[model samples]
Target: MDDLFAPSDVSWTPVSPKLAAVRRVNAAIIFGVLAIVALIALGMSLGWTYGVLGLLVVAGGFAWAWVLIGRNQRSWKYAEREDELLVSHGIMFRQLVVVPYGRMQFVDVAAGPLERAFGIATVELHTATPATDAKIPGLHPDEASRLRDRLSALGQAQAWGL
Candidate 1:
């Protein structure tokens, strides 16, 4: 099954490790809010004991997600081929997307507030078919820009049959 998604000959490029850190921070913020809410709500409705228990459960969930975020981030990789680009990720339900240069209508590089704070960007490829479009996240800004330009040039060249 792994062999089916990942080719042995291709040299895969991994996203920045900062992705895991950013994800962990995001998870922490979410879980922290949940914990506070749970503690307050449960404590008021039930008892302080139940509130602490709820907070514990939320903490456990965050711990599990923290591990998963690292694994998931490590799994993300993209490889550029002669004619197409391959992006693959996911630990359990893996997905591999192949986007042909000729099929790409546009490429986008974007960085949200958090992503910009972390100095990372996402590169999205748009095709005529929405289902064929794909995005790679956690790339450095420079790499994202270079990829966007390169992909645009490649797509144009392929479209022109040059």
Candidate 2:
């Protein structure tokens, strides 16, 4: 039987670990909001009992979210083949998207404020149809640009309509 858990023949390139930093930043924001809410509720005479319990639950959830985010970042990967590019992610659901070079219309590299601050970028692949487009996130800026250019060149050279 084929190995169900093993990766395929194509060698996948894993995303930058710096993505965890972005996720941590987002988790920090959520915890901050929760803290403010708890403070407001306590200040409004909502009783220290409920306020403290709510804070504890929210704190636990925040910790769990960090674990999930770390797993997700570790799972995210992409590979380029002779005919197509593959993007795969998800710790449980296992999503894999294949964007044929021939169907690719363009590729873009983008970084948001947090991503830029972390020196990482995301590459978006646009196929002839919106349904086939995909994104690979958390790559170093230089790698993202290189991937964007390579995909663009390959797409132009081998473009075949969907």
Candidate 3:
């Protein structure tokens, strides 16, 4: 089963560990706000009992999601092969996507505000078939730029019309 998802020959490059930290922080911020709102709203309208319960429930949800986010981050990996790029991720239901350079139409690099603050970016490869397109996130900005250029060059070299 492990072999099924493992890269063929090239080594797998795991996303930066900082990815987990960033995601956890995002989760914490969202959950924290929800907890605060729940505490205030429930306390004001439904009494302190429900307020306390709501806070507890939200806290538990954050804890659960925090662990899963770490696991999911650890699962993300990518590898560049001679002809294709391989991206694999997910914990419960794993997925592996292979995008051939010849079939690539273009490449894009994107970084959200939080991602930019964290100095990380995502590289996405577009193909004629949307199903074969793939994105690798949590890469350093420099790495993402390098990948985008490399993929664009490769795609042009191996150009296969739509």
Give per-model CA RMSD: 1.2, 2.2, 1.5
Candidate structures ordered by TM-score, highest first: 1, 3, 2
Residue range 1-162, candidate 3, lDDT tens digits? 887888567799999877888898899999999999999999889999999999999999999999999999999999999888899999899999999999999999998888888889989999999999999989999899999999999899888542
Pairs that collide in candidate 2 are: none
Clashes of each: 0, 0, 0
- Over 47-106, each residue of candidate 2 has an lDDT whose tens digit, in order, gives 777788778878888899889889989989888899889888887887778888988877
Residue 87 in candidate 2, Cα distance off native in Å: 0.6
> What lDDT is reached at residue 94 by model 1?
97
Q: The CA-based lDDT of model 1 is what?
A: 0.96
TM-score of 1: 0.97
lDDT of 1 by residue, 36-63 (tens): 9999999999999999999999999999
Q: Say which prediction, candidate 1 or candidate 3, comes out ahead on TM-score.
A: 1
- Show the lowest summed lDDT stretch of 10 residues, model 1: 1-10
